[model samples]
Each structure stands twice: as structure tokens, then as C-alpha cells.
Target: MASAKPKFPAIKPGGSLILAWQVKGKHVVVVGGGEVAAGRIVHCLNADAVVTVVCPTSGLNPEVAFRVSEGQVKHTDRNFEQSDLDDADMVLVAIDDPAASTAIWKLCKERRIPANIADVPPECDFYFGSVHRDGPLQIMVSTNGKGPRLAASIRKFIAKQLPSNAGNAINSIGNLRVKLRSIAPDPAESRKRMAWMTKVSDTFSWEEMCKLTDEDMDFLLRYYPENKAPSFSELRIAQGAPDPQGVDPFDGSFGFSVGA
Candidate 1:
């Protein structure tokens, strides 16, 4: 008999890989001191990158000037030079001089270093997405350099639907998970813990989970050995928590079409 067609479709190419790059302790070179460059530097600093700005001091905007004055980033008070790319793990070009920017981009290409030349998508090795941050939680929206304003709007819409305390809930859950692991170290109990945690997660709302206490956790652990999670009603009663206020679900469609 002929082979039946596969149920799933083949992977589609041509899309950027959405990733959270770990840049901590790595060197990032920013070759401008304009407003866009200031924003790029801030993002790099947030990721704990060792940032250095190479621009004439006269070119620096107020924000970039303040960052330099505070000693947050090392500053080279001149235009970019070939030696600037020597220790750079990543490069960001935000200068208005297209010829200079293109020249630097070509150098980065020869050195095989990833670079993003602002306002020139063709020259960029990567694109930045509009990001929403809440503690350890981050939501990013990308339109592949086609519609950045729309991406920002989409990010704002998503942020409104999430509970304000969602990050706190994640932190609380992490701590509880660590405590649970310390209490149940037996290898054979792994599956039970896994199942119990899964059900518990499915049953609790972000707000309810954030309110979990030590006594509540102790009571919950009693059911772990049985490979069971407490029911939503049971947990609510134990913790005196209220039902979650639901956000209207997004229909997974955009109201308006977006294009470059």
C-alpha cells in the first residue's frame, strides 16, 4: 500500500527565530549617541552586557550623556574605528551617516559579528522587538521590521490582559517548587510530584497562586504523595481566596491589517 500523507505540515522557513539572547558579561558595541542609540544601550544594559559607546561627545543626546556621566558605560569620545569591533560580541549602528554605517556593517560581516544597522533592515543581522517587562516576565512582539508601531500596539494590548501580579505569582511558584523538591527527594516520587504540580497549576489562577502561604503549601504537600492536586474549590476554601476576574480572551485576530 502507498504511504499515507503525514498528518502535520512541514516546517515553514523565512521567519526570524524569536529568542532571548543571554548577553550578560559579554561586550556590546554601540556606534552612535543619538536617541535610538540611547535606547539600544539601555536594552543592552538591562541584559547586563558590557556596553561601550563610540561617538563624538558632541553627538550625544541628553540621555546618552547622562548614562556616560554616571559611568554606566565606557565611552570613546570619537567616531568609530576598526579596533572598536575587536572585542565586540555584538554591534549596533545607529548613526545617520548611511555610508559610514554601511562600511561598519561590511566590517562586521567580514568578522562574522552580528550587527543591527538602525533604519536599514537589509543590513541588519537581527531586529529588536517591542518588549513588555514585568520582573522575570517578558512579552515581545515582532513584525519582522515591517511594522514596528503596530508591534508596539500589539504588545500594549497583550500587557493589559495579563494580571498585574503575574510576575509575583511566577516568583511564588518558583519558591514553592524549590521547597517541594527539598521535601521530596526520592527518585520514585518524581512522577507523583510532576502530576501533582501540573494539576495544581491548572487549578489555580495567577492571583490565587500568588496568595499561597506556608500553611497552605504544607496542606497541599499532603496530597503530593497520592499524586493528586487539591481541587480549585478546596484550595479556595483553604486559602480564603476569591475566584479569578477573567480577562476577555483575545480572538487571535488583529483588528486591522498591518503592512510596511
Candidate 2:
């Protein structure tokens, strides 16, 4: 017997546009209580948004209950209400009830609020992309509502390539920039000095960069370009290896009919 083939779509996602919303001190509302809703609530909390979950109380997931207990989220023990969306920066409707979810979507549209509905891409005003966050560095990946699991797998790959001390390494380099500005205020000369800073920073391991004191950073800024590259005794030290983990790139093994 021959295997069935896949159908390809001629059209693709429109394009990629990226923006970071400043959610700190803002309110975010989620209208569901299951795993999907709980996941969105956690993301809002991470962004420092005051989160409120509005749904029937009896079906709340364990994660939601835990977040409420920890004071990270507020739970309103009732169905979603339009008034709940007041002052909201964003809304997520994860419930399966199409009529209710549609009502929420219309309300958000009227209020000009960005909204996302789990498992229902056509109704979404935006998507929750896979996010890789390191202290001040954030990478967001989106497959344009096509393959969220694939997006998540790619995010894990990119995030793992960064050194563990990346945050501190960036701070060390930043301080050097400030010092250069103080010493060489002239624009053209400062550009050349900035190039040297970039080159010297690229030569060291992020761990070694983090270990450098302000004195070491100053030394590098002073003698770099004139001096040869720093020795790798500290820079090249192998801090042992990390445990390997299997990576799954595919979304699923479950069988579903395309012509159903």
C-alpha cells in the first residue's frame, strides 16, 4: 500500500513583525482555568503584569490554584465579564465554548485590546510566541500561527547556545563603553575605540568575562588594539560538560485525518 502525501499551501504567513510590550504595572486578564490559561497567566506574571483569571471556579487547574495561593494571580470565581476587561492591557480567552469566547473576542475588539485565543488562530489578534529570556536579553520566535511546538523547539536550541554568564558579560562590556565615552568624547576616535572594545570582548569566554573585575575591564580598554589578545588560560578553561538531553522537534505522534 502507498502512503498518503501531504498537501502544501501556496500562501504563507504574511510576514514577521516583532514588538515587545511593556507589561510591567499593567493589568492582564485570562478567561479560562485549564492548562492553557494557566500557562498564559504564568507568562503575564513573568512580565510583571498584574494578572487576573476569570472563569468558573470549579474547573481550575492545579497550576492556577498554586499561582493564586502564591499571590501571583487573582481569581474571580465566575464566568468572564466585560467589566473584567476594564484597564486590561491584553486578554487571553482559552475556553472551548465558542459562543462565550466569541463574545469575549468582540468585546476586546471594541475596546482595542490585543487578544489571543488558544488553539484558535483565525480569531486571534496576536500570538504568544516562544520566548527565550536571559536577564536583559529576550528572543521571541513565531511560526506565524503554523507550528507553535516547532517554534518552542527552536527557541530551546537558540537559548542553549548562550553562555550561562551572558548577563554579567554584557554588564562588563557596558561599563567599558561608559568609560570610553568619558575618556574619548570625540565621535570618530570613540568609534574606533568602540571597535576595539567589541574585538576584545569577543576573544574571552563569557564566564571569563564575568570573572573580570572593573580593574580588568579598565586594563582591557586601555591596552586593547595596541596589545595582543588576552591569554586563554582563564578564557579557555573547560568548566566540565553539561548533561545531554534528547530534543524532540516534531509536534506529535497522534494520528489525525486530513479529510475528516
**Judged by lDDT, which candidate is best?**
1
Question: Candidate 2: minimum summed lDDT over ten consecutive residues — where?
Answer: 251-260
Q: 17-66, model 1: which lDDT tens digit per residue?
A: 99898999999999999999999998999899999999999999999999
Runs in model 1 lying further than 4 Å from the true structure: 1-3, 9-14, 186-195, 210-215, 239-260
Compose the digit string of candidate 2's lDDT tens values, residues 205-257: 67777766686655555444453344323222211123133222122211211
Best by TM-score: 1
Evaluate model 2: give its lDDT. 0.74
